[model samples]
Target chain A: MEALLEVRELSLRFGGITALSQIGLAVAEGETLAVIGPNGSGKTSLFNCITSIYRPTSGAISFRGEPLTRHSPDEVTRLGIARTFQNLRLFHNMSVLDNLMVGRHLHFRKNLLAAVLRLRGEETRHRRRCEEIVEFLNLEPVRKTRAGDCPYGVQKRVELGRALATEPRLLLLDEPVSGLTQEEKEEFAYWIHEIRGRFGITILLVEHDLRVASRLAGRMVALDHGVKIAEGTPAAVQRHPDVIKAYLGE
Target chain B: MDLVESYAEDLRFARRPAARVLLGLLLAALAVFPWVAAEHLVFLATLIALYSIGVIGQNLLIGYTGQISFGQAGFLAIGAFAFGHLRIWGAPFALALLGAGALAAVAGVFVGFPSLRLKGPYLSIATLGFGVAVYQVFVNWEVLSGGRSGLAIASLQPMFGLSGTRWTYYVYVLLLTGFTLAAYNIVSSFIGRAFVAIRDSDIAAEVNGVSLTRYKLLAFAISSFYTGVHGALYAQILGHIEPQIFNVLESITLFVAVIIGGVASIEGSILGAVFVTLVPKVFANFREMVPVVYGVTILLVLIFEPLGLFGRWLKTRLYFQLWPFR
Candidate 1:
């Protein structure tokens, strides 16, 4: 498989406290890679660096062979990467459709003048694109609802829809199954396969549920204290004594 | 993934129906003001509408994008003085209006650059300083702005050879109505949703592919451009221009109007504009008790209706609908 992303000895620090310490990773095109760790184990921190939310203190990140530098989060997104926030940061006041439509901001080609006039078939095209995205997410039923009033599971689904709207080559999921129940996790695990199977998009997930990650991901990378301790197929990594010790509290 | 999908659904549920009807009625009333209003009332209405344009500008920056701006009046002053000076040089009214808007947009960019590095009260104070500096320029530059004494603007030429105060009043009213409608459409459009997204969470907006620098600056420039057009309109309607017309207090007044009406609500601005403009007249009726009346009303609005009249009305209506049947 062709390499879609690469991170070499990436390190991130906030003042004197090191959050991500010389961690290295690479993800192949259309592949699913799971990063599993306990709370404060640099899972989200690694995501922040990959998404350019927290600029790495030392190390290199490349997407599709292009070096990633001090670019804004949106810039990183424009380069075919999109991510969902762990805390759920949906635009609460806007309509359901509008939230997804905002994900397509990069697709807009017209200026304020053209937008105001609704000129040259712009409105029609814009409307068509919005409808396509809404349908893709199965959001037609509540396309006009406000984002703030939804249940936890559905809100998480909206975040995925938003990420998918970016037309990303690589989608980052930060604890997608963290707050869900076992049944909900099972449903989410099913959608994980669907996202990859239907969209042919690469996914790099950071999850805490070992069983879910092992089931959903073809391979897994384990981290403890901001360092990768093990990485391989789920069964191989599970039998590795370190992985067992971390999981079983040995 | 689930979080994102559910938020999308919630957003669909947020649009209210009664608000749209109220907005439509307000726009219709404003559109037909000149026919029934007295000359002085027409004059006052023109002023109110022009100021509403400034408030709308503030709303774009602070209400939509969550950036506090105290320099919108400075942009308004720039527009007023620029258009007035251009008119003196024999520029057509429309050209003068566009020129003022363009200049204000450039100024907006300058002000907004520093803002990308600042937030909260720091941003407010920086903009406040801009407003004060602009006022000083108008005070000192007698050649262009007529200094402290100010400059006189010629009466607005009537459309299609029509001439009269009534005709001009109608013209101003219609123009303002058009602008209000445009502003309404903008706030409801996709880009407008981006602004709200930026306001709610800049990081989230960026992750969703909204370029922060571009969108925020666009908000400032567009907001300032509208204020510039408003300034030109005010100059034409009043036939006078002065620094005092766009002072720091003017900035406060615009903000108060936005907050009292509803921060991000277009209809709220119109209601707030009318209230701010007419409330003084309410005090006028009480003669010596004018200040007292003004104070009491302001206090009551602040204490009893924190979201202003609009919030109170929404709450009351909701109460009636949900109350355990009569």
Candidate 2:
């Protein structure tokens, strides 16, 4: 399969602290790639570099063979990348349905005049797509609920739904199932695998929970102290000595 | 599709057909009001209508997009001066207002560019300086005022030779109606959702593919354009203009009305504007205490109802829905 995203020797630093150092990874089209690391192990830093939230201190990231060096976050998103935050960065004051509509903002074409005329055709098309995502996520019950007020699990679901609404080819999920129940984790793992096939998306996820990460990602990259310590099948990575030392507090 | 789920969805928005009909009747009453009311009352209502449009525009910026501005009066001044010049040159009224709106929108974008990096008190101070700078320019520039003495606005010609306050009165009322609907459509549509999204979390908004620069400037431009429209109407109704019309205090009055009515609610802003305008007249006897009274009213509203009158209205609506049992 063609490489959809390639991070070559990515290094991100904040003054003296190294967030990610000489990190490298590749996600193929329609593959699940998980970055598993302990707290402060630079898992999120990797995601941020790819999304262009933080320009890497050194090295390069390319999407579809084009250098993503100069792109801003929103520009990166428009290039068909979507992501969800680990702590759930949702529009707190807006209704649940409105959040989904926000995700479809890129696809809206009307401006001041057409909107003032109550033009329904353009708006209705986007609304129909948003409603489909709502229904799929089983969020119909809290469709009107303010995202801030939704239960944590539901917020995570909405965040995912929101990213999905962007119609992205690459989905970056940062700890998508951390706070989810056991059943939810299993359900979410199913969706993770299913989404790769269903949407033909390349997913790069960061999760600390080994069981969930190993279950969801076919291959895993383990990091320790800003360095990629191990990479291979999830089973093999889990048994690596450095991976054990990183998670076991050695 | 089940009971609880559907009910919650329905309650999320636009829950009242009967109440909407009642609102339509109230608007019809407003339509015919100019004919029956005394001439003085028509003038007062027209002032209220103009300010209603101004405050509605103000509400969209601070209330919806969560950007604070103390400089809308600058846009109003720019529009009024531009309209005053156009009117003096014998340009038609509608075209002149459009020109005024476009000019003010240009200024809005110009000023709103650096303002994108500002928020909270920093944004407020930047806009406050803008208002002051515009005010000084109007006062000092002989060209802007047609001289320090100010310019005279042309009287609006009667339509179809229909002579009366009723003709112009209907025009103002109809424009206000159009403006109110436009505001409604904006808040309920994709454009408004983008505003709210940027307001709530700009980082998340960018990640979700909203261009902050585009929406922020659009908000400023749209907000200023409407304020300019209000300024044009103000010039026509008053028939004279000076820099004094767009002072910092004038900006405050509109801003206060928006807060007192309800921060983000359209009806709240309009109601607040009318209430603030008329209440001062009732206490015209104690004219010295008007500002004092105004300050106290706003403080009281903030203390008792931070959401302004709209919060109480929404609560009352819920209360009535669950009446008798609750």
Candidate 3:
């Protein structure tokens, strides 16, 4: 399959300190790839660089062979890349449903005039689409709940639900299983697999737990101190001496 | 993937027939207000309605979009002057009112664009400058605003059968109701969702494909149009105006009205307008206590009810909903 996303020699630096060094990653169409690393492994930084939240000091990111530069964050999302923040950046003040509606914002083609005049023809259609996503995630119990008021695991799901509402082709999940209980993690992993099975979406996940990462991801790339140390099957990368050293710092 | 549920069906509130009846009756009473009430009281009601219209705009920007504007009165000034001039030139009231609002919307774009990247205190300062500049324009532009003396607008009575004072109540009420509903529609719609999302988190908003620059400018445009229309009507009701009428304090008062009424509630707009308007009358006997009362009221709201009148109203609703229990 053709690579959906390609990163060439990606390097990010903050003043004198480096966050990522000569990193390269390729995600093929409808494939699940995992980036596993210890703290300061540059996983989150890699996602930021792709999203252009922080422009890489050196490197190139291409989506379907198209360079992703000069596009704002919203533009990037509109280009079919949606991501979740590691810190669960849901709209805390808004309800879970409204948070999903915010995800549908890009789908709206009506201008301000059509909106102010109370044109429901387009709006109701979009709301129905959003409701489908809500049910898909089994978030009906907390549909009306404020994001800030929900439990951490539920908030994470809501964040995922929100990212899903945007109809993304590539979902950059930043630690989807973090803070989740064992059962919750299993259930979430199930959903993640189903997301690929059902929607054919390419997922580039950043994860901390090895078992969960290996379970969900078909392949793994391990980073340590901002450098790529191992790449292969999850089990193979897990046993790589350099990766072990990076995780243990031994 | 088999799920077919839609919030549009589930989220629809059961039709409230009685609420509509009550609103109709209340509007009927307001329509007849000028004839039944004392003429002076009718005039006060008209002013209050106009202020309510302006307050709705102010609150939408500050409360819903999380954008701050310290100089909303600038839009009002633009509306007032534009409307006044359009009316004097034989333009009809409806067209002139819309034209005035459009003029202000353009100014909103001008102010809103450069400040797209600006947020919080910096945005506030930019708005403050805008307000100051508008006031200065009114003061210095001799031909446009007739300078400090301001120009006399055509009386509402001769135009559209709205007798400057009494008959104009119906017009004010009509505009107030229409704009309030429009504001409600905007808030309930996805557009309002976009505004609130930006208010909640600009970064998240963009990530979800909400263009911050577009929505930020939109909030300013919609907000200023309302305030501008109110300003136009204010000139008509007052029958005369000067640059001093819409000073910096006037802008601050409008901002405060939104806060005390309810930051994000539609009903809060009217409640805030009425409370803010009546403050001067309730304390008309002792003018010195006016600011004290205003300051104390805001302080009290911040302390107890951070969401202002709307927050208190929600709490009351929940209490009633959970009545007969602790």
Q: Pick the candidate with the highest DockQ.
A: 3
* Every candidate's lDDT: 0.79, 0.87, 0.87
Tens digit per residue, CA lDDT, model 1, A1-250: 6689999999888898888888988999988999987678888999999888888999999999998867889999999999988889898877777787788777777477655543424444555666776676567877778888777877787887888878899999988888998887887888888889988999999887878888888889988778888899988877888867776788
lDDT tens digits, residues A146-200, model 2?
Answer: 9999999889989999999999999999999898899888878877787787778
DockQ, candidate 3, comes to 0.73
- The model with the greatest TM-score is 3
Better of 2 and 3 by TM-score: 3
Model 2: residues >4 Å from true position, as ranges? B1-16, B160-164
- Computed on C-alphas against the true complex, the DockQ of each candidate is 0.39, 0.55, 0.73
Write one digit per residue (lDDT tens) for candidate 2, span B249-278: 878887888888999899888888797789
Please give, as one word, the docking class of candidate 1.
acceptable
Pairs with steric clashes in candidate 3: B156-B162, B157-B162, B157-B163, B157-B164
The backbone clash count of each candidate, in order, is: 36, 0, 4
CAPRI quality band, candidate 2: medium
